[model samples]
Target: VGKIPWWKEAVFYQVYPASFKDTNNDGWGDIPGLIAKIDYLHDLGVDCVWLSPMFESPQKDMGYDISDYQAVYSRYGTLSDVDNLIAACHARGMKLILDLVVNHTSDQHPWFQESRSSKTNPKRDWYMWKPARYDADGNRMPPTNWRSYFAGPTWTWDELTQEYYLHLYDTSQPDLNWENEECRKAIYNEAMRFWLDRGVDGFRIDTVNKYSKRTDFPDAPVTMPGETDQPAAEMWCNGPRIHEFIREMNEQVLAPYNAVSVGELSNTPLPSQVLPYVSAAAKELDMVFEFSTIRLGTGGPFHGKYLYREFPLSELKAYVATWQQWLEGTDGWHTVFCENHDNGRAVSRFGDDSTVELWEASAKTIALWQATLTGTIFLYQGQEIGMVNMPKEWPIEQEYKDVESLNFYGEAKASGDAERIRKTEKGLKILARDHSRIPMQWDASPNAGFTSAGVMPWMRVHDGFKDLNVEKQEGDDESVLRFYKKILKMRKEYSGLFVHGAFRPVLQEDETLFVYVKDDQGSEESGVQVNKRRKALVAMNFSGQPASLQEHDLDVAATLGCKHGEELLLVTTLKKNDFSRMEAGVLKPWESRVYLNF
Candidate 1:
C-alpha cells in the first residue's frame, strides 16, 4: 500500500473510437475526434485512456481483426494522427493504451496471407493449421467440434492449402500460434514495440488467455441441446504455457518501457486463476478485466448471451465479495467495471433505468459501488452521463451493428425455430454488445453530435439522446456526470481508504442492500485493525423499494469508533442521509451513501 503505482491511484476511461466523435463527417470517429476530447477526459480526472482496437482491419469484427498491427485503420486516421493523440494526452498528463489483439490477426494480414497461400510457406507455422477430419460418410469436417466465439466451427477450411485454420473468434480472424517461438518473437519484436516506440503508454491486451491453446485439439463435449458446435472454453483457456507466454511478453516489452498492461482474460472465472496474471510477484500483467462479472445476466451455454437470465441482487453481491475478499491480502489487481464496448450499460443493466429520475440515482449508486472497491475503476464513454441501452424497437440493421448480434439473428432465422428466434430477439433487447456500441450522445444536435447529419453513421444513434446527452448533464450539478466527478475527487482525497484499504463485506446475506467496509487503519503483517479510526463504509440499496441497513454481527459501529457518529461523504439521492433516517435505519430506494467510519 505504500508508494502505490500510478495506475492503482488513477481512474481509466475506455473510448470506443467509432462512436466517440466525427470531425471529418466521415460517419466514423477518428483519432482527431478523440484528440478533441482529451481535455474533457482529463477534466474528468481520467489518468489513463483504454482505447478499443483501432488497428488496420477489415472491420468484420469492429476492428478486433487486425490486418496490420503497426498501421492505423484508414477510416480512423494515419499513424501521424495517433502520434498527435499520444502527444495530446501526454500534454494533458494522461496515459493512452491501445487494444493489442495479438491472439489473432485478420485473414488479410500479410503473415496470414503468406501462411494461407501454401502449406510450405515459411510463415505457415505462424498460425494454427490442421488437416480436415472426415466423419462416417467421409464428409470433410472441421478439425474438431469446437465453436468460434462469434459462432460456427472453430476451424475454417482454406481452398488454397486444402487445410483448416483454427480461429477461436470470427472466420476472418485467425488465431496466432503462440507456442511457435519464432511467431512469439515476431509479435514481441515487431507489432508490440511499434506502438511502445511510438509513445503509447501501454496496451489493453485482447483475449489474453487464449494465446496458448492446447495442442491436442480435442473435440469439445456437447453441453447443450440443439447446438451445432461444442463449446471449447475449457480447452482453449488458461493453457499450460499461458504464464510463460505472458511473462515473456512482460519481460520483452512491458517491463522495458515500464508500460501499463491490462489483459482481457476469457474463461478465467475465479480470482485464483486470475491472480497469476496480475499479481506483482508474478511479473505478468498489471491488471486484468475478468468476464465473470459481465456474465451475470447471461443465459446458459449454446444460446450463450442471446437468452436472458434473471439477475439476482445477491448473486452480484457474491461476485463483488468473492473478487474483493479474494484479493485483499494479495498484490494482484483487477479492473472494476459494469459497461464496456462488449457489454450493456451499467445503469440499464444493474441500476434503475426505467425512468430518468430513477436512472440518475441508480447510476450514481452503481458508481458508488465501484468507487469504493479496492481495484481501479474504468468508466466507459457516455456512462458518466447515465446513457441507457438502445430502445428495443430499434431495428437490427439500423442500430445493432455488432457482428455477434447480426450472427445471432441470422442463425436464429435460418434455424426456423420460431420460438427460439422470438426469444433471441427478446434477449437481445435486454442485453447485447450493440447496446454499448450506440453512438456517444454528446448533445441534442443531429446524430447526437457524434457525426454530421449529412453523413450516415455506420450505426444509428440512440433516440434517447434528446434527453441524455453529455451536454445536457454538463451544466446540471445533480447529473450523473457531475456525481461521477464528485465521487472521483473523493476517491482521490481519501486514497488511503479507497485505494489501499482492506475490504470487508458486511451484511453478505442481505439481498436488498450492499454494505462494505474499507479499513485503512491496518498493516501488511497483521490484517485490518480498527486503530486510529480510518475506516469508511459504503452502503447501497439495490432495489426500487426503500430499505434499511440493520447493523449486523459485522459491527460497523464497533469496527469504526462509535462515538464520532458519521461523516456523510457521498450519496446518490438529493436528500442527504438525515439523522432521522439514520436513526430510523432506512436508506431511500436506490439510495447509496458513503460515510467515514468515524
Candidate 2:
C-alpha cells in the first residue's frame, strides 16, 4: 500500500510475442497487438512486461538468433511499434524489459558474415573461431568436445575461413568472443544504447554468464552419454572472466540509469557459484533467475525422459530456503518463477488436472508459493488463467515444431532405439513447444476470441478454451485470474512482509505440504501473530491423497502469528478438524489451500 521500490517488489508478465496477439492477421502475435493489450496487462496488476526477443531474425530460434540487435523483427512489427509500446507501458507506470541476446548472434548478422568472410577480416576475431584439427589421414575433427545446447558439436566448420566457430547453442548462433575487448564493448554499447535510447527500463539478459568462455575451450566432464553436443561445462557456462565482463558492462551501461536488470542464468550450482552473479557489489545483475525448479523432471539434455520426477515438499522448501538464505546474507536479489516461454505450464508439470476444482486449487497454490517468495515474480501469459501444458493428444507434428525437438526426434529414430524413441516422444509431447506457445484463449468464441476471422493460429489453443477462456474466468471471483489479481494486490499491500521479511520454513517435516512464514525485522512477533491470526499457513498437499498435518518441534511449525490454538490457519488437505487425528485427508491430487487465521 505504501511506496515500494520498483525493482524489489514488482510482478513481471512475460509476453511470448508470436502467441500474444495477431494484429495484422498474419497469424503471429505482433507489437501493435501487445500495445493494444497494454491495458490488459495493467489491469492484471503486473508492474512490468518482459517481451521475449523482438529483434530481427530468421525465427529459427524464435528471435533468439538475432540478426539485427537494434531493429524489430518484421514478423513482429516495425521500430515505431516498439517505441509505441514502450511509451504505452511507461505512460501506465509499467516498466518494459527487452531480451538482450549478447552471448551469440545470428549467422546472418553482418558481424558473423564478416567473420566468416576471410581469415584476415577485421571482424574475424570478434567471434570465437579456431582452425579444425585433422588427423594424418586428413580426417577433420572439431577443436574440442564441446556441445551446442541445441544438440551435436558446438563448433561448426566454415569453408571460407577453413576454421570452426563456437556456437554454444544452434550452429546458426555463433558465440561472440567476449574476451575481445572490442567485441565486448561493441555488444555492451549496442545492447545498452538500443533500449536506453528508447527509454526502456532494462534488459532481461539472455545467458549473461555464457558470454565468457575459457581461453582453452576445454571439454566438459561428460555428465550424460550422448549429450556431448552441449557446451563443455568448462568451455562455457560460468567461465573465468564472466564476473569481470559483467561488472565492466554494468559500470559502462547498466549502472548509469535506475534500471532493473535480471539475468537469465541457468545450469549453475547454488550457494557458492550462483550467488555472486546477483550480489549488489557485482553491479552486473539486479536479479538472477535460476532454472533448477523448472528443470526438475527433465533429464540429460533437457530433451531427455520426463522420468515422472517427484519433488518432495521438503526438497522444494530446502531449495527455496537456500536461495532465501543466500539472498538474505548477501547484497543480492532473486527472480522467481516456475513457468516461462521455454518451460511447460506449471500446473501440468507440478500438479494434476483431472478435475476443474483440483486444477484451480493447484494453480492457486502455485501462485501463493510464487507470490510469497522474496524475489521479483514472473507470471507468463495464460498462467493467470490456470493454463496447463498441452495434452499428449494434440497433433505430435504440430507440437514438435522447435528445431531442438525435431532434431532429437530424428536422432532417436535414426538410432533405432525403441526405448529412446518412446522417451523422446513422451518428453517432447509432455513438454513441447505447443505447451508454452499455445494461443491466448481470450474468450470462448471462435479461435478463443483471439481473432475475429477464420484463420489458423501459429499453434493450437487448448480445447478447454470453451470453458477456460478469459471471458468466463474474468468474471468468476474465484477464477485463477481473479485469484492472481488478489495475490498481486496482497503482495503490493504486504510488500514489506513479502519483500523484506526473513523467510523461515513452517512444518519442516511435512513432505506433502510446503509452508513458510516471513517475519519483518521488528515485526517478528507481530508477523507471527498476523500469520497465525490470518490462518497465514501456506500449505500444498503434494501427495495424491490428503496429508494429515503433524505437530512438530517449535522449529518445525515456526509460528509467525498468534500461537496456533483451536484451529490451524490453513489446511490444504480435507481432513478432520485436528490434523493429528492420523486420518488421511483428500487432496484430490495437487490441490492447495491457504487460510487466514485472523
Candidate 3:
C-alpha cells in the first residue's frame, strides 16, 4: 500500500476508442479526443483505465482482427498520440491498461499473407491449416465439425494449398497455430515487446482461452440448433496446454515487467482451471474476466420456446460467489464486471430503468456492489450515468459492425424462417451487441452530445440525452456520476477495507433485495463491532417494489458515504437521503443503503 496498488483498490474504466470521443469531426473518436478527457477521468476518481484495441486492423472485426501487431491505426492517430496519452495519464497519477488481441489476427496480416503465399513460405506454419476430407459425394469437407462463433463453418478451404484453415471467430480472423513454438514466440515478441517497450502498464488479453486446442482436431458437439460445423476450437478452448503456453508467454514477456494481465475467457470458466492462468507467481495473467454470470439463460431457439431466459438473481449471485470464494486466500485474482464493450448495458438487464429515479437508484446499487468486490472493478463508458440497453423495438440497421450479432441475424435468415429471427431479436434484447457498443452520451445536444460536426455516428446514442449527459451530470452533484466519483473516492480512502476485507452474504429471502456484507477479521457475530467493521455492509434492492427491514438491522452506522443523511453526499433524484418506514416502520420500496456500523 506504500506505493499504492491502484489496481487493487481503484476503479478501471473501459473506453471503446472508436466511440469514446471525436476530435477531427470525422464522426469517429480518436486518441486526441481521449486525451482531452483525461481530466474528466481524473475527476471521476478512477485510478486506472483499460482501453479496447486500437491497433492497425482491417476493421472487419472492429480492431480485434489485427492486421499489424505493433503499429497504431491511422484512424485512431499515430504512435505520438499514444505516447502523449500515456504521458498525460502518468502525470495525472492514473495507470493505463491496453487491450492485447493475441489470440488471432486479420487474415490479411503479413504473417498470414506470407503463410498463404506458398506451402514453403517461412511463415507457412504460422496458422492452423488442414487438408480437406472427401465427403460421400467426393466434395471437399472441412477438417472438423467445428462451427465458428460467428454463424457459419469454422474451416475455410484454401484453394492455394488444397487445405482448410481454422477460424474460430470470423473467417477473416484466422486462428494462430499455437502448437508451433515459433508462432507462439513470434506473437509474444510482437505484442509484448511493442507495448512494454512503449511503457504500457498491463494488458487485457482477448479470447486467451481460444489459443489452446486439442491436438487431434476433434469435432465439437453442436449446442446451437442446426449447427453442423464444429471447428477446432471446440476441442481446445481452455485445453490442457493452455497453462503451459500462458506460463511461457508470462515468463518471456509479462513477468519481467510486473504488468497486470486480464484474460477474456467466455463460457463460464471453472475456477480450478482459471486459477493457474491468473496465478500471482508471475507465470500467467493477473486476473481474468469470467463470463459465468452473463451467460446464464433458460434456453435458446434450438431448445423449445421459453427454454432460454434471463438469469434469476439467485443464479447470478451464486455464479459470482463461487469464483469470489475460491480466490479468497489464494494468490490468484479475479476481474469483476456487469458490462463491457462486448455486452449490453447492465442497467436495463439488472436495473429498473422504467423511471429516472428508479434507474438512478438501481444504477448506484450495482455500482456499490461492483466497487466493493475483491477483484478489479470495471465500469463501462455510459455505466457511470446508469445507461440502459437499447429498446428492441428500435430498428437497428444492417450497418452494425459487431460480427457476433450480425452472424446470429444471418443464421436466422439462412433458415428461411421468421421464428428463429424473432427469437434472435429477443435474444439480442436480453444479451447482444446493442447493450455494450452504444455511442457514448456526452451531452443533451445533437447525437446525444457525442458529436457536433453534423455527421452520422457509427452507432446511435441513447435517446434520453437531453437529460442524461456528462455536461448535465457534471453540474449536478446528485447525479449518478457524482455517486460513482464518491464511491471511487470512498474505496481509495478506505482502500484496506474494500481491497482485502472478507465478503459475507447478508442473506435475504427477497430476490429483488440483493444484499451482502464485507467485514474485517475478528468480529463475525456482532454486525456492529469495530475490529470486524471494515466497511461492514453492502446491499441493493433490485426489486421494484419498496423494500425495508422488519427490525433494527444491527444498528446501522455510516452509510458507506452514500447520500442518506440530512446533508446529501450523492443523489441522482431530487430527494437526498430521504427514506420512509414500511407498515412496521422498517426499510421500504427501492430502499438500498450500506453501513459500517460499530
Candidate 4:
C-alpha cells in the first residue's frame, strides 16, 4: 500500500467570497478581506481553502458566469489582491483552491461576443450553437426539450445568427464547446494554466460533469412529472466523452503542476457512475462531489430540490453507509460535506435550530460525524459558528438575490395560484441557496462586523448573529467553533486511522443511532508487514429525543480488541450532568461520542 495523498488527509474550508468578509467598507467580501482572515482559517484547523469563483463576471449568477477567466472581478479586487492572498495563505502553510467554472462562460465574454456576431464568425464554433427548429406556423422552437437547471428552456434563441445556444444554467452563462479541439487547448492554456502557473494549489471544478455533450444533439427523455417540456439532464450529464476530456486535462494541466482537482458531478445517480471520474487509475479527477447524501432529506428526486421535507434517520444512515461500502477498497475517494454554497445551512437542515441548546448539540453532532468519516471533510463559511437558515419572515423582494430563487419566485407569481406561491415561499425558506449566502457573522456590531456600520452587505445578515457570531463563540469552550476545532485536531492526531482505516457500520438497523467504526488492522506494503494498527468508534444520535443502547448493541468487547473497560472516551457532546446519564446507558438528544481502543 502506498502513502495516502495530502488532500485525502486534509480538511477543506469553503468560502463564498461575497459573504466571507468585507474590507474597505465595500459592502462585499474581497481578496483583501479574505487575506485578513488567513489566521482565522489557520486557527480553525482547516488545511485548504476552497474559494468560490472570483473572476470577472456580470454578477448574473453571483460570479458563476465568468466573462474573463484570467482576471479578478472588480467587486472582489484587482489581480494583485489575488496574488497577495495566495502568498498569504501559503505563508501560513495552507493551500488555496480556486473555483474553476469551465463548463460555461458569461455571454459577455469575448468568445461569446464574436461567436454571436454572425454565422460565419471564426469564433462561432467556440460555443454550442444549433439552427432553430421551426414550427408549422414558422415560429421558432428549441433544438431540444432540455431544460436549464434553473428552469425553462435550455436553449436561448439569437436573431443575429438565426441559431440557439445551450445553457444548462442561467442563460447568461453560455456552454462552451468542448468538441472543438482548439477551444479545449485555448481554454486549458488561458484559463487553467494562468492560475496553476501563478502558484495557486489546485481547483474545485464547477459543473465538471456537464463539459461533454452528445454530439448528435438529441432530445432528452422526460423523467419527472411537470418536466414534459423541460431539458432532461440524462442526455448530457457525464456525457460520453467526459472521461476522455478529463483524462486529457489531467495529462496536460493538473499532473504536471501536481495540483488536485475535485469535480462537481451533478445528476450522477449511482456511486459506480462517479468511479471513473475519481478513480486513481483513471487519471481524471482527484475526487468528485456527489449529492446523493445531501439530497437524502430533501424529498428524493420527485419532490425537487426546493421542496422541504423531513428525511428519516434510517434513510440518512443507509445513504451514508451505502457510499462508504461502495468505495471501501476502490481508488475512488469522497468529499464529505454537510453544507455548501448551493444549499441551506446544515445546522438548519440536519440539526434542530429551534433552540440554542438543540442547535449547538445538533450542529456539533453533525460536524463530528463528518470529521470522523473516511474522507476529506469540507466546512462551509460560518458553519463553525452554527449558522441557521434565513428568517422566513423576510420578504423575498428585499432579501433574496440568488438568480434561481428570483426565477422561481417570478414563475410562481405568474401562475396566479396563491397556494403554489405559498409553497414556493416555504421552499425558499428551507432550501434556497441564499440561505447560505448571508454575510459572515463576526460580532454583534450593527452589520454583525462583516462590514462598516453604514455600508450595507450584498445580502441581508442573519438576525441571530448576536449570539452566533464568531467573537462570542471564539472563547467559549462549549461553542460549536470549539467543538469543530477539537474534532479537526483529532483527525490530525489519528491521520493513519481516519484517513486509511477500513470503515464498518455498527448498529446498522438502529433507527435512532448512527454508529460506525474505523479499523486499521495493518497491511503488507512493499513485501514488508507494517505494524500500524488502531481502532475508533463513532456513535451519533440522530433524533431530538434521548436514546439508549445495550452493551450488546455496540459489541465493544469484541470489536475493541481489548476489555470493554479499556475503552477511552475520546470526545462527546454531553456535559457533566449529561455524562452521568450517559454512564447509565442513556444518550441525550442529538448527542455524539467517539471512543478509542488503545
Top-lDDT candidate index: 4
Which has the better TM-score: candidate 2, or candidate 4? 4
Model 2 agreement with the true structure over 547-573: per-residue lDDT tens digits: 444443322233535544433433342
Candidate 4 global TM-score: 0.96
Which lDDT tens digits does candidate 3 get at residues 1-598? 1343446666788998888888787777889988998899988877788889889998888899999988888889998999998998999989888998877889989999999888899888889888888888998788887766676787898888888888878999998989899998888789777787887898989988878888687766665555565323447678878888888888888878888778888753578777777667647787788877655662532222222476667777787678666777676767768888776677777777788778877777777777777667888888898877776666544534577777776676677878867776677666676567777888877887566748788777667777878888889877888888887777655555555566666553446666666655412221213333355566556667755543425223433422344222221222355633123223344555555643
Which portions of model 3 show Cα errors greater than 4 Å? Answer: 1-5, 222-226, 230-234, 297-308, 522-535, 551-574, 577-588
Cα displacement (Å) at residue 187, model 1: 0.8
Clashes of each: 0, 18, 26, 2
Off by over 4 Å in 2: 1-4, 222-231, 302-310, 522-536, 550-558, 561-598
Question: Which pairs in model 4 have colliding backbones?
Answer: 146-231, 147-231
How would you encode candidate 4's per-residue C-alpha lDDT over 184-226 as one tens digit per residue?
A: 9988998899999999999999989988888787876766556
Q: In terms of TM-score, how similar is model 3 to the real structure?
A: 0.91
lDDT of 1 by residue, 248-326 (tens): 9999889999999999886888878989998889999998998777777888534466888887788888887887777
lDDT for each candidate structure: 0.83, 0.75, 0.72, 0.84
Where does the lowest 10-residue lDDT sum fall in candidate 4?
521-530
The model with the greater TM-score, 1 or 3, is: 1
TM-scores of all models?
Answer: 0.95, 0.91, 0.91, 0.96
